[model samples]
Target: MELLKLHLIALFLLPTSTLGFNKCNFPAIFNFGDSNSDTGGLSAAFGQAPPPNGATFFHSPSGRYCDGRLLIDFIAESVGLPYLDAFLDSMGTNFRHGCNFATAGSTIRRQNTTIWQSGYSPISLDVQYLQFSDFITRSQNFREKGVFQNLFPEEDYFSRALYTFDIGQNDLTAGYKLNMSTEEVKAYVPDVLGQLSHVIKLIYGQGGRTVWVHNTGPVGCLPYVMDRFLVTAAQIDKHGCSSPYNDVSQYFNLKLRELVLQLREELPAAAITYVDVYAVKYSLISQAKKLGFENPFVACCGHGGKYNYNRFIKCGSKTVVNGTETVLAVSCKDPSTRISWDGTHFTEAANRWIFDQVVGGAFSDPPVSLKFACNKMNTSQK
Candidate 1:
């Protein structure tokens, strides 16, 4: 009788929702994009990201480009799932939750014709889909063989999981690198969004019913671009960002939102929501003082410049300046108080703040809270 009483007490003390039984209804989360959402994907692929990159949180390089966790990490944690492991790092990976297919320098375009940058990305959106297919096949085979039966999800896991996309920034950056005019870059939006829509439709066809897509953030505020273009005070916006770049970002976002509406109509069974990451990001810059950020424009990890950002001496590099060897990407004394990380990405603190705003439902279309979106039923045609 005493033991029974103890067991009852223990049950009451336990959290309502346990691991693998999330209240949000999402059994897993699969992500695809570039550096913004990449955890260790780039490092696993090219072995490029190194030290001080993950200093603020992991205290060691975790292959994330920022000082800490990205927005995707926060989202995974919010939904009661483990951090999504990079697909390239297949060893010891726990795919029962989800997988990350983002690469640091990846672009949506398959060919280099649209991308001005050199080299080829083996894991483009199309390639990431292929990887997902392979994973599905392997898991099915394992299940059929009755191996780790309880370790994997049911046969319809993809339809129940959340599919997220945070791409397109790299393509725009490439266009700028090639010295394309604003009009020329704007013209490229249709092609980029078309590819993105194609991927979304493909996922839907493959049983993905809930998709959350983040629009491109304000690239104008990145110290990398501001340092290069905002030579005069007049060129900077009130928020200390490059107006030209922000304008381009705004244009892209407008078109992306429109596309989301179209997708919603076409895929009535799918919960296709657009997340306004740009507004959340820009808010941090515009309200830096209120947000407790001492330096909103300067990069937390960079070298030798007004904003401490040098394209040649990017973060995690070393260079000799004036006969003295200096670490190119030295971190600031307090990364938590800063906004930008390496001129392009946010500090972990900033990312956390952004996540808080995004999950609140105000920044999402159809006004569905992130938690609700995850838990909602899929209306996609069977």
Candidate 2:
């Protein structure tokens, strides 16, 4: 872990040319996604992700589901922007740089059930787009009033900012939770991506130009999926992931890539990059030991179970055993050395590692670095 940290530190110190990129002076960033990129939308809307979640960096439950920063946070820092304050949050939010519309349980398509019913967010991707649209108009109005001009983004910032998306993971899991067959889940991917496409177009219509889209990761390797879902001995891969589930996730990503290509054709002014975080994440899980980590399937902050997880008692929830109160340890003693923070989200360390790999466009479709994402690339350039 120390070695990885040092390598990342050195990576940040290198020149722009060494990383195959030029600098882009992005004044702001607008993000829309699920928990993977959600800074605080879900936490503020529901309840804050209770303690140990932000222990690694924020030093408190800073409304994130993981131990520290998410990929969005890393991206923000790299681009010289402030961490996006959740749009739902009315607290000390600063929208001057940007706003985050992502919630923890958000999916691309709206679910039939409420948050309580399906454990999925009612604020789906469409709702997020609405929120974003509202933010633009409302914030502008508020700024015009001159009451909080400093708290809002400049009118031109929206058009100049980089837009990021890291959703669709929950959409895949939502189907599995409903006992849908893998084929059934795969069948509806087009519909899901259709909604995603609509939202991106909506953003583009609103003047969003540089778009960054991350494909979903390997859900099968997540402790939450492995513990909650049923997988036979043969179903588990050599890396201990559910092969069928991973296949479904990969299929979702493949279609998502196609959608990106389609969007590029439709939106001539937009520079869209489809990031393959799935490959980077899967490699990390399958080669955890070689990558300097422990069993990747185990939850670092969960209660006792095969994967140190219980769907009923989540990472921050408590349980009583033998009349003794026990809080599922908010964080493990060595969370920095682990991958899964609470059976679902990645650890701060893991998030950092993932950020390092993808920032250089190594895992991106256009193979254009994040700094130069505004320039549309030829697919054949790589």
Candidate 3:
């Protein structure tokens, strides 16, 4: 009877070319981003501050800019993977599956001037890919295995594993806030796109075939900007999302789509998919009323009001004396009720729902459908 059971198990495990089996075979994820995808990694590198950064949930700062998980966390969950540890974290080096390289306040460009207050200097998308190259080399050496050994023992991991890049908001924000000339901004954009293209080439050069590249989002509408500019309540749309920001976001998204399409043509072997976070996030905000999100624009943490985040006052500061005015803010009753955990980041709930659209369904655009992107690589594996 035991022999029969073993035979049955072997029969069930026999390799088949079904899409479900192919989809389930993808091994791991490699991620890059700013605070949007950071998961307590920066804190591991920079240490944490009290009262402000993590006052809501972790009771102390946890590297992540938000009270809890970020978008990367949700994306990993959607794909049946563990919460990826920051590649920089001490415990992360041994993990074979996923490694996140996002840092809080990071932009697509290294020296983003927009939010200097956050003490954030992005790893730039170029640097991010360069680091990926280094990571591959080191991973091969440390494990004493070929680069693709753990990634794809069956020669299919490269095709099966997920690759995600979430960046660009910082680039647009820096360009606009720094008052860079239009020609300068326009010229700089191609360089940035060129850098992105180069990064895609590097990944493809290293055998990365399936990737999900996220475009920029509505930065102008962020509470930080709204409060800084003192935008009128009426200027904000019904969803409390600012229109100008959304418009700019749309433009950036359009350009990004064009760039990725070009990369696809250039790197024919890669199956790159574009995730339109702008539309996904916008649709989420539009449905906030029905989803029971009380304050789509209001931040769950930090000082509240028009700004939600006081760029001047700074969160977790002791500037306010006992007799002084209330400067420090509190988190909301239920963080789930809000779409934003801070003035600039998304709530866990919002992240999960958006992940559902991009990773869990057909909302992903270009290159090839995500389903094709993930499975195509495996099918081509030799």
Candidate 4:
């Protein structure tokens, strides 16, 4: 009788997430950020992501930087929603499941140089929000006009849809590129996060109630950072990643988490989930062998360097080899065993693995699964 009573108590103490009644019925997902989630914003504005970019799944350039799908693709699939169409992409677009406002090379704070000069996108975070603002009106107009009605989302979906953000990595790298020290980069994090919080408030003003924010990943482990930056032997961590860069990334995440907490108080109606992508990514890179992956720091597709990365000429760049025209930096025969596709981006396999790790809220603040991220937590999640 005592054993039966204890089992009943345990059953009653189960979290609400296990209950089907508490699961969110999010009809759509609106994503915003940089290349990590950029479906095709940059491609639509400039040009298509060339061949070998989406060779794994799409079998063609599907406007993503990775070899196949991204974490956003997995997130959408988890919720039974279709892949999000880029807001900037006008061709064959359907916004019924919301749109992606992310573009490669984007930064929270606008850069001083042009894309050609600094490799940063002209479309900053604020610009993306503006595009989103315009999209809200434009989609409604198209719906009312009785033209392209099927391509537009329902008017009420905006309020209930999950607003996801996975940016701020560029902001950290931008500072490093400008020759800023770790302390200098840390100094300006507040401003960068201020802009991020401002945008969240803007979304809140737009009646968005559910917000999902992914903290930046391990920037130190990226091949581009390792090859581009001069790192001393002592700076390399056990995983062969630059410790300084990763420290800066962790600091940025710390500040970002604080900002998210402050925003939670600032917007009582919103349920904001701060995802620790840094921890998840770092764990994968650190334990690559055990998890069945190659050297985590090496680029799967690149021309040269210890990391197989060349910043000047990226993947898919064309060159002449032995008097014949050839495509430079083609993908490896097997990308599933690799962690990085390009020097800067994760492979589809790595993305899928990362998604699997965090899908159950293992790395989320307030300890809520994506389905229940909208519910406000009264205490810190385990």
Q: What TM-score, computed on C-alpha atoms, does each candidate reach? A: 0.87, 0.93, 0.80, 0.94
Q: What ranges in model 1 sit over 4 Å off?
A: 1-23, 111-122, 147-153, 229-232, 319-326, 374-382
* lDDT score at residue 98, model 2, on the 0-100 scale: 92
lDDT by residue for model 4 over 1-382, one digit each (tens)?
3323533543444365456436888888999899999999999999998889999999999999989999999999999999999988989989988999999999998999999988899989999999889999998998999988888788899998999999999999998899999999999998999999999999899989999999999899898998888788999987788999999999999888898888988998988988888988988898888889999888888888888899887989888888998998888889999999989999999999999877767677765678787677765533
RMSD of every candidate to native, in Å, equals 8.9, 4.0, 8.9, 4.6
The residue pairs in collision within model 2 are none
| Quality of model 4 by C-alpha lDDT | 0.88
Best by TM-score: 4
Write one digit per residue (lDDT tens) for candidate 2, span 184-273: 999999999999999999999999999999999999888888777867889999889999999999999989988888899999999898
Which 10 residues in a row give candidate 3 its minimum summed lDDT? 373-382
Put the candidates in TM-score order, highest first: 4, 2, 1, 3
Better of 1 and 4 by TM-score: 4
Residues 1-382 of candidate 3: C-alpha lDDT, one tens digit per residue = 3323533543343235334434444577888887788775566667653455554555666677766667777767666777777766784343467677777766666673333454565465666677777877676665565453553123335455788888777666666566654355555666666777777787888888777888876775577767765567677787776666566667777777888777767877666777767767777677777767865767777665654776655555445577785546656667767887777887666776777665533344532334445643322110
Clashes of each: 2, 0, 1, 0
Alpha carbon deviation, residue 346, candidate 1 (Å)? 0.5
Which scores better on lDDT, 2 or 3?
2
- Global local distance difference test of model 3: 0.65
Give per-residue lDDT, candidate 3, residue 79: 66
Off by over 4 Å in 2: 1-22, 319-325, 380-382
lDDT of 1 by residue, 7-114 (tens): 354344333332322345788898999889998887887775867899988899888999989999999988888898888885567777778888877777765652
Q: Give the TM-score of candidate 1.
A: 0.87
State which candidate, 1 or 3, has the greater lDDT: 1
What's the true lDDT of residue 82 in model 2?
91
